[model samples]
Target chain A: AQSVTQPDIHITVSEGASLELRCNYSYGATPYLFWYVQSPGQGLQLLLKYFSGDTLVQGIKGFEAEFKRSQSSFNLRKPSVHWSDAAEYFCAVGVWGGSQGNLIFGKGTKLSVKP
Target chain B: DVKVTQSSRYLVKRTGEKVFLECVQDMDHENMFWYRQDPGLGLRLIYFSYDVKMKEKGDIPEGYSVSREKKERFSLILESASTNQTSMYLCASSLNLVQGETQYFGPGTRLLVL
Candidate 1:
């Protein structure tokens, strides 16, 4: 069984500060990882995904994630946090070639940015 | 850009009432899915369809059913709405297993069963 864990339930960061949200996954083989963001009262938006390639992948809204196989982690990072960047973040792991190909997601981390 | 739209953004239903939630995607993707999101529970798959008239149970399929009469539309049905079913329902679509791996999501329908 595949699962995702987001260690931080909530993270508060000041504007212009660096942000890092932690994520870890448990899978048997190579996994497809993804990060998604959801604003209040809205659906989720794909931030970035990693199939297979360089460890570091860039995504929309100046977000990036690094896949560390050794650590079983795919951590999302931002050099600077903006007030508007406050949202709920989720880490998901995809089952490769599964018939339905559904994603298993973490509990999510709520980000709060202070002005 | 691919667009997935849900039938309603907010819905209120009474206990034991039958409820229908519809989702449509313009991307012509072959796979459509239904999921429920709750606080601290994340997204749990309810049902999925790989083709028209075909449906498969996901992790959490109890108290729910689905219909995929067309490739572009998927409908989730609650046989008897219960308070426990009150949550945000999301719809998603993606290409076939090989070509389209990323699932595009709709704005979601918030269902409240009283």
Candidate 2:
């Protein structure tokens, strides 16, 4: 069985400040990773994904995530966060070569951007 | 743009009542999924269908049933709704396994059972 762990339940950062959300996963084989964001009363939107290749993968909305196999982690980061970036972020792990398998997701981290 | 739509945004029902939630995808995706979301529990898959008329039980599919007669439409059914089933239900669709399995989600249906 695979599982995802997001250590931070909530994070607050000032506008224009760097942000990092931690995510760790337990999987046996090469892992497929993804980041998703959801605003209040809205469906989740994909932020980024990592199958294989470069450790650092860029995503939509000026967000990026780095996959560290040694640490069993895929951390989402942004050099600077805008006020609009405040939302709930989730890290998910896909099973079976990213095939038609269920995704295991973290509890999610709520991000708040301070002015 | 890929679009996934759910039948309802909010639903209130009584315990032991039968419930049906519909999901449709306009992108012709072959894979559809149903998930329940709670405050502390992010998303737990209830059921998924890789092809029309073929369904698979997910991690938490105890009281849920699903139908996918058409490729674009998937339905999740509760035999008898309970208080524990009160949660936000999300629908998602994705391309076939050959394509990267990045799912696009619907707005979600918030179901409350009294």
Candidate 3:
């Protein structure tokens, strides 16, 4: 079965430090990938997506993710972290097909930025 | 900008009561979906519709049902609300596969059943 995994359940880093959240997926074929962020008491917002073409995709809030087919990974990264950036991030894989297009989401990784 | 709106941001209901959660999107998307979100489980699809009046079961659809009488509206119904059904319900909309669907989510309704 196709599934997504976010190994890190939670990560804490000092403000202004670099951040990376790992995501791995298991699928039979090349799949559509996405990153989303959800702040406390809020819905998820799309951070970036990888459908085709350029392996590196940039998304809102100065976020970027690179899709590596060989590694079966799409990791999200940011150069510097902000206190406001503390939120839960999710990695999802699209079940790309005809009319049954839906997403398989990872458990989620919660980031907490320290002062 | 695409806007998805849920009827209630927070709801409290008694157990065994029938519950209705309404969602509407203004983007005129061809597909709409209802999902339940828990603390550690991320999001699980309860149901989805590719077109008006067309519905399909999703990963966890045992305690829920859906309706899509129009293109932009999708409603999630809890047959008889249970304590275990307390969750954040999210609604999303997207285009068809031909258009390369990317879901847009609503603000979400946090339903609390007691």
RMSD (Cα, Å) of model 2 = 1.7
What order do you get sorting by lDDT, best first? 2, 1, 3
What's the lDDT for residue A21 in model 3? Answer: 99
Each candidate: RMSD to true structure? 1.3, 1.7, 1.3
Q: Each candidate's chain A: what TM-score?
A: 0.96, 0.95, 0.96
lDDT of 2: 0.93
lDDT of 2 by residue, B2-104 (tens): 9999999999999999999999999989899999999988999899999999998888999999999999999999999999999999999999653237989
Model 2: iRMSD? 2.3
Count steric clashes of candidate 2: 0
Q: What are the lDDT scores of the predictions, listed in order?
A: 0.92, 0.93, 0.91
Instruction: Please list the residue runs of candidate 3 whose C-alpha ends up more than 4 Å from where it truly belongs after superposition.
Output: A97-99, B98-100
Which residue pairs show collisions in model 3?
A: none
Angstrom error at residue B52, model 3? 0.9
lDDT tens digits, residue span B1-114, model 3? 999999999999999999999999998898898999998898998998889999999889998999899898999999899999999999988876432357899989999999
Per-residue alpha-carbon lDDT of candidate 3 for residues A1-115, written as tens digits (9 for 90 to 100)? 8899999999999999999999999988769999999998888889999999999999999999999999999999999999999999999998765546678899999999999
Give the CAPRI class of candidate 2.
Answer: medium
Please give the lDDT score at residue B52 for candidate 1.
Answer: 98
Model 1 chain A weakest lDDT span, ten residues long: A95-104
Better of 1 and 3 by DockQ: 3
What is the alpha-carbon lDDT for the whole of candidate 3?
0.91
